[model samples]
Target chain A: MPEEVILQAQRELPDWDGQGFSLLETPFSGVKFKRLLGRTRDTLRELLKIPDHFHILFMHGGASAQFSLVPLNLLGDSKCAAYVDSGYWSRKAIHEAHRYCQVEHAAIAEDYIHTSTNTAYCHITSNETADGLQLSLALKASTPLIVDMTSDFLVRPIDFEPIGLIYAGAQKNIGPAGLTIVIVRDDLLGRAHALTPTVLNYTYQVEAGSLVNTPLTYSIYLANLVFQWIGHQGGITSMAKRSQTRSAMIYDVIDASEGFYRCDIPPDQRSRMNLCFKLPDEPLTQLFIDHAAWSGLVNLKGHVQKGGIRASLYNAMPDAGVVALADFMHRFRKQYADL
Target chain B: MPEEVILQAQRELPDWDGQGFSLLETPFSGVKFKRLLGRTRDTLRELLKIPDHFHILFMHGGASAQFSLVPLNLLGDSKCAAYVDSGYWSRKAIHEAHRYCQVEHAAIAEDYIHTSTNTAYCHITSNETADGLQLSLALKASTPLIVDMTSDFLVRPIDFEPIGLIYAGAQKNIGPAGLTIVIVRDDLLGRAHALTPTVLNYTYQVEAGSLVNTPLTYSIYLANLVFQWIGHQGGITSMAKRSQTRSAMIYDVIDASEGFYRCDIPPDQRSRMNLCFKLPDEPLTQLFIDHAAWSGLVNLKGHVQKGGIRASLYNAMPDAGVVALADFMHRFRKQYADL
Candidate 1:
């Protein structure tokens, strides 16, 4: 019940009565943005145990932007940067890295499609949204690690020491589909490539306190609101517990099914946030998507290669929403048992 | 009356009975952006007689962003780019250009306390918001010209051939903030330095139809609404007449003040949109600002200069607002005529 409190916070968001402002442009610097950002720092620090030497920056562009930025700032005399090709985003990161410095894949997780690589900065997606894989421990690499944790932020704790940098686009589980939250070490702030745009140079924003060129002010405001929501639900320990149960509930349904439904992910590699699975056939998957849509469950269509379904249980998605989805899957399975 | 009818069109802008789906984000295919952009093109073409050879782009990051971009794409491999320093913005353009190539100033209009000078690009503000100065025409630049016509858009029919590139930060006169309307010749776009970030690359944006990434969707929506608003009011010609009348009314008061007000800049170089003037001392200016705030006429304080008052009358500021300010100025002048 305490875990369900976050949904209440999300619903009561923006607090229009007191906010003196709407979720419009310019910082509701008056109240909303500052309070929420303060709450974000507090909640994140409390949950993730961020230390004095570290900083969490709210920025625009996607993880794609950081690809070039990381090398521009981090790569010194070394001409080559490195990464692991987990999915679309990692490949995208490597493509951008090539534009700045040489890029190489240290390793690639073939079976699970999770990246296993080593290089200047070993990169991987902690939770693969498309492939439905989430790694609990740090993916070991000889080089400094840069992980894209866009889908699994705050769902679990992060090890700050081994990781040189971590960037998460705030869409999948962080917040809305804009703001990017980056946690980088203090030393990494200013070592930008001389050619880097002042706007993209992390230190420029850091020195300016992220008010660099007006920002995605509203998105940060919303993200701050969401961080507060997470804190209100007893922070990350509670969130991890709830998310574990949430992931288990859906994965259990997949496991219990006698081939009536199917999930391609090996049980060990299943994601705590995204549960990607499939129906008996392509036609059945489409039908299931339509059935789910009419019932107020949307965005259920799986990725094109992995057809079936993907249910992303982010912080905002309540346990009840998961239960409702599980219940719908059950009834639909019975309805089409003949298949 | 026709003007009033067109102003009323802004109130009915959403088309969905205020539901707001009409102005949703333009998607990747840019079908929606193209349709609205097509409408904008056809309307502007009819109104301004814009040649088909020139290109229009709807982009993110306003003229401040373009100030650097225009030079990057224009200077090519040239050692020096000439500038016309007029006010706060022209100086900014010169600074941004210095990052890329050597910059030469043809004019420092404000260095002589807003006196005119000969500068290449003759980069005038057309309307300066901070100092409230608007140049009626390009100040005779022999080389290709780039103008930051942000605060005054379409005040008159511009002979685009005379201007190589015209960029506007939309918030002031065109629409809401975050969108920049860049009208550049087709040849000007493709010459960006290899290091230019694709977002800031004018050539990339124009080639891609300005739907590069998920732009500031809401800002562009507001800009399209403003373009439609201008279209309904007999296009730019009508806006020019009304705006000219508004500026003339304020200038008339300043000219008649009998030494109570000291207008800056020579009469020949005076801006029609922004009539910059100063009071005898700081106390009177502070009092005017304080009084203006109390009367709900905000943003009138002079930008951190010694001390003065600046009133920015963009397209959104109704004529009645100017009249009210003019009326206040008349009262203030008469009451303190002894000063």
Candidate 2:
């Protein structure tokens, strides 16, 4: 959502790179598109600092699809995979993995922690968007590690040595919604089940250069623009620093609110990307949401299942936006403190 | 590809519906996104004249994924599925189907003729984009019929009564590449194999409102604009007429060229969307492609497997483009006649 990226896309909507036709008008297999695809992959590789041994796959179906794909691809001879049920997204991954193989919940909830196991692989949700929980542990497992970094991918730099696979839906830190970025170690390519769909097979996808079919060309193009934007913003290191500064602003407000606003998760497990909190009651929460919306701040409502309020501090969210939210929260508490 | 749609999208890229955020900046599960999703589906339903009994699914992974999905979903108790090997896409569909069930090649190549079979379903590529072959036969089968309408999905009206399911990747006549439109009869739901991935399962997709995960929101939004564009162009009947007229212009040029150019597919089975033909040799073909590119008519190169020229005349392609192509072809033949 960077202004430059949006303006570039708008300017190139009818014609791409002076090509006389839009990017959407190009054939997926054409030389021009192949170059675009290569440029996109190269830019992403540079941005993520992906090791040469890892295959960066541009796939569809979002990170939700990877919940099944991970098990289907990595759970070859083993009958079970170890999973840490941190919160909402981890639970969804666990549920989906059950269709492919038996999943062992190594730990659950606030007490959830990853441990080495004899299972095929260990899966963890790096950040849970719904419950505002995140795995900040220095996770070590005997088996390969699969991380669903849907909410906080590329928000910070991490060591790729211990991770066998990393998948993220590109809606949050990455780019758009439809595209899924799967970074898999080359050693794990041909381990998919025989019945796994061809498009979902890591080996086939890598061989096809993610052009197994006409890929989400426009989405990938937008993702490339996002990658460039990230580069301009000093890459992941700068993004991480900004993320901490922004999240701390609102968390500081919540901490000093004198029981007015409460964040349930322990500080160590709280997600920097999505902060979820509660007011005293449902009516108060509704009023908080309405007031926020009236002040031109929208999408601040909490997940219906877990009522309260939630604020997403993604990489694209500016520090000023977070400061505004903090200021509004302080004002609202003063206005309703006597109630 | 319409100017109005692209301009509207460009205008809305920075702020959507007067909201102080871009559509890409909105949460997929938010109310604004839900409304956008509903509007897209409603527009598609109105454009395609989809029946109430059909569950329209907006999915990812494109038409190639459905090559595996159809067999995985519909081939429950039946060990075999009937498939007409029309051309490139049908063969790919069959190859994928072989992973799930025994595929009975009802017919192959020019001998392809649809017949009733006691299998799970009869699959066919309605228009083969590569070989420029199409199934013009009024297909009837004892089992359900699954059609891959990738290239020419909405080029003409289709009868929904006999067809059990219809899937089209959105890159062609629809919109962009990330989205796939699946129109499934209600009875086809809940019949998927237990091992089928949740995202690929029709029942799950329908139940989830195609929000099983964050879908290709931007692609779906563009597709909705394309549907509106089609409606403004007098709907499918008008589109069919235009397609015929445009394709006829090119076919007429080929017919009058004597031996200079040739289209092999029989007239009845030729695809109106993709017009494929060959010049005398590789050099001539290369020359033709270069000349076409010089004239701002790019992406006219044929599929490498089919070693010829293919001009895709999708619904978005205007009449003037086709006329220009025909005029160019005539001039190229005249200029190269001596060689």
Candidate 3:
């Protein structure tokens, strides 16, 4: 992610044409900013193996902003779009979509419970960050797909076809916050509602080379750096393997908890990013979190809706960090036995 | 600008928030990653005297982006806008507005010459870079007004009641090149066309306190440092005086040239920021520029539309730099006899 940002900055800096000022500085035409766009776009196309028909746009407003932007851009009329209620994050996306479009659910697994009822965009969160739910049945028969892979983007490239658009804020595995990286088919860019801001209008940014105004150059630069970092990690193939290894260590401990700890998500549909667990009850969970913080393990508190705790092992989380966390969990169970 | 970029990076730097894992190493948000917003919004707000009624939004894109944004936010189909076209920059703003609304020429001089419209909301460059045209009109006006003070924002503080909004690019007197500072009245926000991008929706940003997304933190931090510099220079009051003194010496030579040299703009309307002049015809002008380059003068070319030498004496352009140009100009005017 870091390298991706630096590369983008480098492309614009020193002025691509050897012009005295950069594209960001000069009022030149789109031709100058075009080279930088071509590089980032082509790189994503190859990495995602994106079909030739799609167009990629790096947009503003994080995923939080995207909730309104996506529905405003993609949802036409109140037609119910199919949204698989995966967890807290997916639910939030749905709540926002409801303001602009109707949503039908293909599957829902919010708190260990799973249900299916297929209906607008076959929308789903690839991995739920708050509740640690990963969708298992993904191949859809006939529906335009909109996947919110904010948590798992680039860890493994998407293979199942006919996906309409995939959007992710650049704060996670992609880059940093403030930028939502959108991969829309060329057709999707122009399908926005009439009320979208020119800056958020995928079609406008597409035509304008994202120079509608002085862009968040520094943040975009940061995201570009992250892309470079992801590429250096041998791209998505390697990212998937590392993610699996990190999740397995903690999953092993949970499976061996001997009833001292418990997890909710079904085994077939487990997440590699966020691992949520409960320590018997409220008091015990609080005590363990306290001890963990003293040990420099922080932000271990679970989402308020999901009591217990969640350990987020993102791509940047060194394998050693996960190992240490798993070891802490093991020691915590032992301490309870002593008590 | 630098702080925003740095802190935003720190927040996404994995283990940020002491989370066992951060989203940055993976993908950005919607994917559920949170990047830094910056240390404090008030740090920027307090420096600008931005009225509390208006929410401060740090936006992406440059002042050019604002060309489309201003019309979207401030003028609807029913409302007519009048622009005082003093030079090329105002004409550009008028061109962008033409796409959205009926812009009227409230006043414009013959041959794009420099003079005071001195009317309400008379949109002018305040400090023109390409032609070195500056208006000596008083800031107070009977009608609401907007000014693209891109070249000399914060160079001085006027009472500001008569001004509706002021937009400035950070490259010149403000800071670096990537950020654009827009100080608009509370009522003018969110008044744009409904179809504008949410990114360009100043109303949305003003409401969000500019944290609508990760802004160009680095460039904005640099802008903040510039504000501090202004503060150190006894605010804009002292800045206006210093610029006046520095520019007087140069303009004095041209105004009193006795046909040796010439400037298109009226002496009263001459710019203190950028000063333009010529030595009779094309031959002598080219020769003067060539000799001046060897003497350390650079970027003195005039706008292609208005051919003459232009010196941008921005806030960063020290008094010494101007004296150097003046000395070189005087020597060049005298050194060649026959030409």
Candidate 4:
């Protein structure tokens, strides 16, 4: 989503690697495609500091696919798993897991950690996009932790020691929507259920080096550019700092608005990726959205499930964009306070 | 894969619809993205002449994923489906279907039709890429026919009345690799197995209008462009004519080679999309491949399973490419015939 990535892709769209053909025209088996795949994996490993024991897979079907795949692949002989009830995404994972195994619902992260040790794995949605909440604590537990990092991946350094697997849909902060990135520990490779679809089988995919089927080659190519851009912009540490500053700029205005603007989420649990808040009334919320769009700030409407204002500051968002949003928020609060 | 599509996409990569953001950065819910999805579906429906009773679903994970999905969705209560074992792709579809239902393996197209009427459905791969064989017969059967038309999808007009469903991976004649196109009858919507992964559940996808989970927006966008290109090139009729002309140029050389070059597929069954052949020996085959690449006609190597020389002339292949390959083939045969 970076400008450099898009511009470079545009420049090379017609001829990739001087091959005299569009990259879309070539199959994944082409030498240049193979090299591009290797470079993408290498750059991702460097950016995430992925351990050698982990397999980084570029797959299709996004994070929703992984909700089913996690339980199907990791359940092993144990028919039970623990899933934290964080928000909408967590509920989806839990709902899908029920069709495969017995799912124990844990109200919080600590409850999942204290879940019966006999469970196969514990699951959490590290950042809930709809509810605008994020788990801020680092988890260490005997059971492998499987995190849906779809909304927060690549925004900060990760501690992968206790993670059995982490899957992120690339659309949020990585690259495109069709591609999903899965990093799984070596120990969790081959315990898929007998009926697991081959395209969703972790062992089958890893054995074929993630070429069991045709992958989203163009999406992966874009992701490779994104990984490089992140590296050039000082890696995950800088991403984390920018996210903090950007979210704080908007959150500071909401906090200073007293009762006019409200963010019900506890400050510690507020999502840095999606900051959801409510205006004084429905009319005011519509007015804010219309005025923001007039000022060239769009897509600020809240998710349908939660009807209020939601501001998402992903890695691609410029600091100036966030500053402009914050300034508009201050002006709107001042103008409407007495009305 | 058309030059026009690539060029147009490159032009819009940075500022899609003048939205000041890359298409890759927008979620499927964005107004522009929803419009793109609508336009893609409309273009596809128009290009394919899909019937009013059929639902066109854009999905992820390609036709390979649909192998399992077909059986899972259409088996109903019969739990038995007949699959024609045409070649590599057919065998794969059968193997995956075996996991979900009782698979009746038929050696050819007629065998599937003669299969018990009680069978749930019948499946076939209309074009086998590895064997360079195409099913040219028009099928009319009481049992619903499901075709894997991955390689020949957009090359010709399709008869959809007999088909319960037809799925194609977009890599070959359609657009890109990550997106799959599924056209299924209205009656085939809701029989998916209880355990079908939500992502692969056809009924769920249709209900959500293929927005069940962020459908591959960028690939679909590219496909829309490709559809427009096909329309501009005079629709499927012109594509079919071009394919015939292009393939005959190569096949004519092989037929005239006096055993110097051989294509074993019966002339009636030879694929217009992929023309597979061989030279007298392995060294000669390698020589042919090298010379073809040197002449700027690349990807002439056959699939590993069949191992000779395979020249795929999909919809995007210009007449010049096939002509160049044919001319090179003729010269190569003449130069090496006596050796």
In terms of DockQ, the best-performing candidate is 4
Per-residue alpha-carbon lDDT of candidate 4 for residues A194-215, written as tens digits (9 for 90 to 100): 8788988999989888899988
Candidate 2 residue pairs in clash (backbone atoms < 3 Å): none
Model 2 interface RMSD, one decimal: 1.2
* Native-referenced DockQ of model 4: 0.81
Query: TM-score per model for chain B alone?
Result: 0.85, 0.95, 0.81, 0.97
Look at candidate 1 and give me any clashing residue pairs.
A106-A118, A107-A116, A107-A117, B106-B118, B106-B119
lDDT of 2 at B256: 92
lDDT tens per residue, model 3, A1-339: 343344444454444356544433443333544455566667777767888676677765566667667776776553567777767988887777776666666654342222223333567788887898776434553556777888888777686465778888666675545566877766666667754555667777767666655554445545555566777879877888998888989989998988787887888678888888888878899998999988877668887787788988777666777888889999999989456
Worst 10 residues of 2 chain B by lDDT: B108-117
Off by over 4 Å in 1: A1-49, A108-120, A137-143, A171-178, A304-308, A318-320, B1-58, B72-75, B107-125, B137-144, B154-158, B162-165, B173-177, B181-184, B232-234, B268-275
User: DockQ values for all predictions?
Assistant: 0.16, 0.77, 0.21, 0.81
In candidate 2, how many Å is residue A39 off? 2.5
How do the residues B1-74 of candidate 4 rate in per-residue lDDT, one tens digit apiece? Answer: 77777889889988888778777777788778888888888888888799989999999998999987888788
Model 2, span B82-163: residue lDDT tens? 9888888899999999989888878644533454455878888899999988776366656677889988887888878678
What is the two-chain DockQ of model 2?
0.77
What local lDDT does model 4 show for residue A279? 91
Best by TM-score: 4
On a 0 to 1 DockQ scale, where is model 1?
Answer: 0.16
> Model 1: per-residue lDDT, tens digit, A284-304?
888889999888776687766
Q: A140-222, model 2: which lDDT tens digit per residue? A: 66667789997898788867877889999998877778799999999988888998899889889999899777788888888
Task: Please tell me which model should have the higher TM-score, number 2 or number 4.
Answer: 4
TM-score for all models, in order of appearance: 0.81, 0.96, 0.74, 0.97
Indicate the docking level reached by candidate 3.
incorrect
